[model samples]
Target: MLKTILHYINVNRWRLIKISKNNFLIYCSVFVGLMGGLAAVALKYLVHFMEDLSRNIGAHVPFHFMYIFLPALGILLTILYQHLVNRDQIQKGIGTIIFNIKRNKANMKFNNVYSHLITSSLTVGFGGSSGLEAPIVSTGAAIGSVTGRFFKLTTHQKSLLIAAGASAGIAAVFNSPIAGVLFSLEILLGEISIPTFIPLLIASATGVVVAKILYSRQLFHLATEGWHLQALPFYLLLGLLSGWTAIYISNVAHKLEKGIFKKQNRYVRAVLGGLILGVIILIFPPLLGEGYHYLQEVLNGNINVLQEESLFSTWLQHPLIMAGFIAALVFMKVIAAGITLGSGGNGGTFAPTMFTGAFLGLFVAYAVNLTGWVHLNTSNFIAVGMAGALSGVLHAPLTAIFLIAEITGGYILFIPLMIVSAISYIIARLSNSHNMYWHDLIHEKNVRPDKDYEMLTAIEIRKVVNRKYTAVKRNRPIKELYKLMAETSTNIFAVLDDEKHLQGVVLLDELRKRIVDGTLSATATIEDLMIEPPAVIEYNQSAEDVMDLFDTLDVWQLPVVYHGRFVGFVSKSNMLTEYRKVLIGQHHQPDPFGH
Candidate 1:
């Protein structure tokens, strides 16, 4: 019945497109935004419902012993679902989305639309200690990809819709439409032009509408008395602290995840990671789940919640001891997040990063207050620190700044936010060029978000290879080369050995020069006349790498070899021709409103 309804809608969609393609695209963008927003709303409610249920259950139990096993149980269930129901490996986080756009032609699997929503809900809802934002973004991207496929849209259109969906997801989550659009452009679709902004803006706005109508609760509230000029130096110090802390989180999470995954058995890893995470949460209750509730408390100047379920509640009364406790939460939050994900839980680092930043800011403000030299506005620092850490960790300063400003309604702190965010971003970038989402893709997969690289990635080297060139054995007489060149309308010839290995290339211009100079020798073999190519291209090399060879050597054509055997020649002209086609296709956006 569902399939029949979808088929009917799809058939009518084509008719609508025929009437007006621009209007159809706009309608499609709106639909994608709605779906993305609905998904975000559903995930948030489900996680909160689970948290409430867990709290009720904990109230009945002593010492909250359930904390010791809840995280592990959640992770185990996530693993089981993937192994049983999903039956396919599901890649988590924003990295997968970026990888798909770069190498997969923006074609995400259909299962992704629901798999992440289900798995991440179970993971985080059951206390997996990770954020819902990453899964939400992935789900949104999948929705756009699937919607495009359903309508049989072009790759460029599909990519646009994907970004639109992601933008909607972020907007829906935070009720910050501009930050959503910026997140998509800055973190997902890199190097987009002005023409591409329409769909993103429409989608983000639609998502915000959906969220406002369906979910009325704000994520965070800041009752800031505003910042003073005297606090500028402290904000700068907080920015530096946020930067160093961002680096610490990235490196520590990377190493911890590596260590956890080294264990071959997934169940054992989940149990062990869950036990460690549970222990950490038992001591630092704020580290449990997304930690947003505690973060709100911190923003509200309610620091006493840190000792609610903590083992150190007795000693947390002392100002110095409480400061140390906040500092410990700042560091342990990352470990809990790392364990949750590394142990097979499905979630993201966004919430955890913000959570840590809030605590770090609180700790700094608390310490400064203790010194009696000057008092600081703890709430302002908390809000700004969230932006600072987000900018430093994600390498998205604008998104972080706007997201915080919009969420807290604290535009008055824009200058401080900017100063801190920029400093933290600079400090973080000095040590690591890419954020956590892009680190593996850039270092291990060699995927980059640069326009040229993305375009080259889209064009396959095999499609542009010219195999029409004649191949003459190296031992063949030079006369055979002339005859072959005459029979074929080609300017280049490949000289191969008996084993079909590429020996060298014989250019028509060189042969013509020899003949014109009257220096041609009939007795000469192909090898004697052949000149070595400046470089040889492996058949499986990426187009970007091939372009690099062409630029570095300044050669027009290079011989392509497969397993040491001569295959064909790839010319710089063909590569650029393909690149131009991609460039044109990407920029040729139809007016969505027919204006």
Candidate 2:
């Protein structure tokens, strides 16, 4: 009765259905969507709490004195969680989500998700210099998997759920549904097919609606000025610089973190990060928090930028002071963000990437302004360059550009956004680390985003099933069947006729039963004992489709056929083992950290 109800739910709820045999896959996707929605809200609240706390404590307390304290606090909390939770996995956060969706896989462990949330919050909140995108993505993927599992979705449906969950998470956090949809297709699923696009759009839009009602958050408040269309050349220059900065940022963080991996103790490594950040913060409090306030000042044209003072200069040179100070701070900000990540902090590179792009834009604008060739607003350049640079480095040109547009609703910057984002993305690809944060993570884990048994769990039955037939006429002797079962060492055999139609299957235990009843010597046909109308597969089904077959059938083995001929059999062992492989080294093996 429960199965019938679930089948009804699946059939009605989901538009895309893979199985012609049953409506079970449909049910699973509905389950994934419902659960994913709820989980997204919870995770957002958790992230918000950490961000709020980070602001309050850093501002009120003397961060200089407490900078060392914050690092110790983060380390102690982490060690304590490691002790209490007894988790054997490294918390890669969003990188883990990207890892799962790269194939028809889902390892959405709730405890692991919780671990990521806590650790990543600590990483960013107290001056770790990372972004918040990591936790959001992890939580989103977890929501999807949990939902799919509750409904017992097929592998392909689960894959779609993973993308949906990721999209929903992005929408909830950023409050941008379209960006979420594009990200789901481009980054998560790697496909934007009509079938996949519809669900992604629905899920992302739903998440955005929820987020908008709750947060009402503003993306960027800057009003774009009249962009010089002829300044296209300058925009390309900004793109080149932004791409270099992004590559530099990625390289520094990855290299430093990798270098530290050769060292032994976790605490000591963390302490080193603390010491570096503390020294930097002693001079610059703006570097201590999320750094948004400082960025806000730049966007508002209110920075106390340092200008250069000549030796012969008289009184205070205000302009020179601002230039020197601003340039120096940008460089220090990079160091702080880099050191924070190198020490195994949990946050993401997303926010930091935007921050770095803003700084890069400031530098270019300052230099451009110095030349007196063209006028550029500090705020507009940073805003537009940030979108372009982020788009380029992340390789989601449309999403980044749209996110920038949506943030400020800037009509003038549209063409520049397009031109700059593409240029930056192209320039960043010149060196290695072409892919964004998680794409690079996939390589470190050595798991191909592509499909294979050792790689992809969803194995097609037609590929591995035995094509030979052991069935005979009902009058065939039981002794002959017994010999066949022993010789083949197969647990089941499909009975078929000369026309190649499925008859029935005989188990090894059945042959033993006939022998014990003294009917072994008699000629009996295989059809009399075989199970008729065995499960079949169309040739076009994916590995994910095959996995759904295993889930619905609940049998150890099933004969696969196309056009009424026995082709092969798929076993439960291959399916389960293949799926579980995703979670294997994900716990034990220590890979290089996220980009």
Candidate 3:
């Protein structure tokens, strides 16, 4: 059985770890890379197979009526799968992978390997306007997480393997190994070093090799010879537009994700999303699914005939009309992609972003050509637009440049890619502080990538809490409270109930004022002088959040609560000291303990 094999591997991996940790990680990275590549292959093939199956089914139906229900069916099936199989509810996506990396120490569930593969494939292949890249990335991260667990890897080692698997998945999908490495570093790992780089590079290259062996077709091509110095200004302008477009798409996608999909009934939302998507695709077939075929048509100057076979062919003949239509499609694509995800469908914005950028470029080229002011190479613009838009959306200019150049075989456009990607990245950075995918992580989940801060986030409030503080009974006189504060060498005193439950705090400052006024009385109880604490820290809350509470409340300390009982108080000084220790430890600085 598989359990026997895992047990054998687990026992031997400890022996290997004794030999060398680095060697064990390097060896494990190879297996993670292979698994990532294989997962990518499997997902891509499944998507294609489902696409073909849908096409065959649509052939027999009148007016392709099956298209309306296909996405709904796919989403419902995914929901059904969640109810039946994923009852424990392991979230499936790149976001969950990144979340686990930062919060869970890269501990991922084994089921993620197949969960996203099945759901995302059904979502995209059955007419959902989304990408498969995220699902594959999720699957790959799961593979690495489980593999690391199998070897009992350290937290940092597990994180590196997760990054390696993600890189391998991207490399396999796009056949761009260098971009894959950059993607992991910029978006996932957030740091670069030789130890991380070598493993990621090996995994990425291995992934591309696997892809080449299995599926040798390139994704896109561009005749970059047409890129001239005369087009420099236009490319710059395109970069600005691409960056703004990315910001718009990101904001709209996130807003829709949080707003319209407000945890409503899945069936109702799915129906609404499907109806709107069906209507849009029926009117503009180029906006359907990934729209890669239509992008090729636009690049070839076949926009007028690209979707002429659709039901809305009456307005498709005129070049000006088609240009305006394509421009509108660029914005609508963002909305549809948002809806596809918001309506319980599973997919990513990667392919749809490229689709939007390419058409937006074509539209700009057409509009300028019609003015008879400047002649522009539409194909070159399309390529640059893809890079710029990707940079803007991802806030990762290097990954954008290399991903486009490698996928399109456009080495000649490298300078232009750099130019456009940089411009777009700057504009996007100004417009939005974080990448589209990172909003939930940074804001809601507090999973930032900074190592020192992450270390602080990893520390719990209980670790730094001052549990030796004196607790006075609520009915204790103010004079006795003064004695307790003086004897305890603490400025703060807690008033506790009979059951040791927290009631309030009695500050020495307040007692000093009462004593100085000569108004203190023997009958005045501690509760009379006690004031409710401004902030409370939970036992399991992160030190980072505890620091935020301190900063927000402008207090030196906050009461730590477990249930309703008073555990202790965590002071700002202790939190800061621990934070300094974590920072120093992260940099391998010499400590007093010689650790």
Query: Which 10 successive residues of model 3 have the least lDDT summed?
Result: 586-595
Give Cα-based local distance difference scores for all models. Answer: 0.86, 0.63, 0.80
lDDT (Cα, tens digit) per residue for candidate 1, span 1-595: 9999778676866555575656666888899999999999988887878777666766676756878777777888888988899985676778889898888878898888888888887778777889999988998999999888776666778888899999999999999999999999889887557757889889999999999999999998888768999898999999999999999989888766554866368888888888888888888888889988888887888888887977878899999999888898899998899889888888888999999888888888899999999999999999998999999999999999999999999999999999999999999999999898789888888998677888898888789989887888777788887678768888888887789888788899898999899888769888878888989988899998899999999889999988898889899999999999998876464433343
Model 2 earns a TM-score of 0.68
lDDT digits (tens) for residues 359-437 of candidate 3: 7788778888888988998888888888888899988888999998888788888888899899889999998788976
**Ten residues in a row with the worst lDDT in model 1?**
586-595
RMSD of 1: 3.1
Q: Cα RMSD to native, each candidate?
A: 3.1, 12.9, 4.9
TM-scores, each model vs. reference? 0.93, 0.68, 0.84
lDDT ranking, high to low: 1, 3, 2
- In terms of lDDT, the best-performing candidate is 1
**Shift in Å, residue 27, candidate 1:** 1.3
